[model samples]
Target: AYIAAPEKTAQAISTMSPSLITFKLEGDHLNRLNIPVIRRCLEKATAVVVGPGLGLHKETEEALKEVLRIVEEKGIPVLLDADGLKAFANFKRRLRVPLVLTPHAGEYKILTGDTLPGKLKDRIEMVRRAAQELNAVILLKSNVDVISDGVRVKLNFTGNPGMTVGGTGDVLSGIVGAFLAQGADPFNAAVAGAFINGAAGDFVKAEKGYHMLPTDLLEWIPRVIDDPMSHVKVRRSVPRGL
Candidate 1:
């Protein structure tokens, strides 16, 4: 946010100001925003991730809805995580395009108006049920991840407890987004991302113990992606069906 732009201002100016990434924010604080810039960016985007830092303002929420509306209309692959899920809490829809949602337990409760079961099998089933209800892929964050696209399900057990550090989920979202933009399907992207992210944390734990930062995971991502299974000491059989 430039903080000087007019409310009707929608265009974005790219410069060599040396920033890693830019987020589009408006109003006094997450209020209504004119999204001509976002629209322009979408022109060149094969995939997009919404809600990493997207605030909890009405306009921000509306912007997410509008972005999804455009994605559905235009067939853009999208991943909604973090704050994005918060904005879409309690909303369900069937999208023809590739859409994957990564939500943890709290967000999951808000989404389905139901609680996940304590049993692992029952939990995976509920994740699958949510996917079916929304007609979208879901990657449930947990000690061991459960991913479902309604009919098919997979589990990931590569991550360590050190990943409780902040910014790790954001990093996972980026990895998943990159794969989506590279044309992998949502399910594959989420699975690959979950594995790589957790593996990175595992690697960090080896070198730095539980004193891990999200940046530590970043340093190990390339190695994990280069040969994902190489980092895994143990691989469990993925549960099939429901």
Candidate 2:
């Protein structure tokens, strides 16, 4: 069964395939859901990705909180993005479960409530501060992606301006979620996710130029991962008559 707000049902159907059941309601309706029903869904899910295309509604926000609470209590790993970050802002403190928060610069500012410095050094410091405070891995998206768990940080400089298109962030979020489902550590998952996502974008740029769209990036993702290295071969051929 799928769990989402009423308005998101159609989107969920299209995005999450196989015709799964959907639980549609906001935070207020969380209590109305039978405990066993939620448990059953949790049991079936290996990992959960929250906040993709989920809009900001009071009831939806509350429901997200409850979902986070239960997931944490059950020791489930979660990948938080988009509206999920907004819901987290309303909470008092950090969450218990291992989580990865994928935020762009603007979203990062909202989560931390701290003004970002215009310089690169200051931005890295800001990311560290927010990650340490939240006790969760942070993946900050920009021209050069910065990922940190408050201890180690990685800078990815693979992507190009072509990646500035919409849904690129969502693609990154999905990549991280896929890694988390496979049991990768949050830090490594973020690193790999950022690297691959950017590398794919770079590949798209090479093939289609800066006008490349987000869908172009998506198609290149598999090719980039399957063979990250560029190949070079020199061949010499002579005619049989020679």
List per-prediction Cα lDDT, in the order shown. 0.76, 0.73
Which runs in model 1 stand beyond 4 Å of their true positions?
1-25, 28-32, 233-242
Each candidate's clash count: 0, 3
How good is model 1 by TM-score? Answer: 0.85
TM-score per candidate, chains pooled: 0.85, 0.82
Cα lDDT of model 1 by residue, 139-198, tens digit: 898888999999899998887777877788888988898999899978989999998988
Residue 219's lDDT in candidate 1? 79
Query: Against the true structure, what is every candidate's RMSD?
Result: 5.4, 8.0
* Model 2 regions lying over 4 Å from their true place: 1-8, 15-39, 231-242
lDDT of 2 at 174: 79
How many angstroms is residue 109 displaced in model 1 relative to the true structure, after the best TM-score fit?
0.7
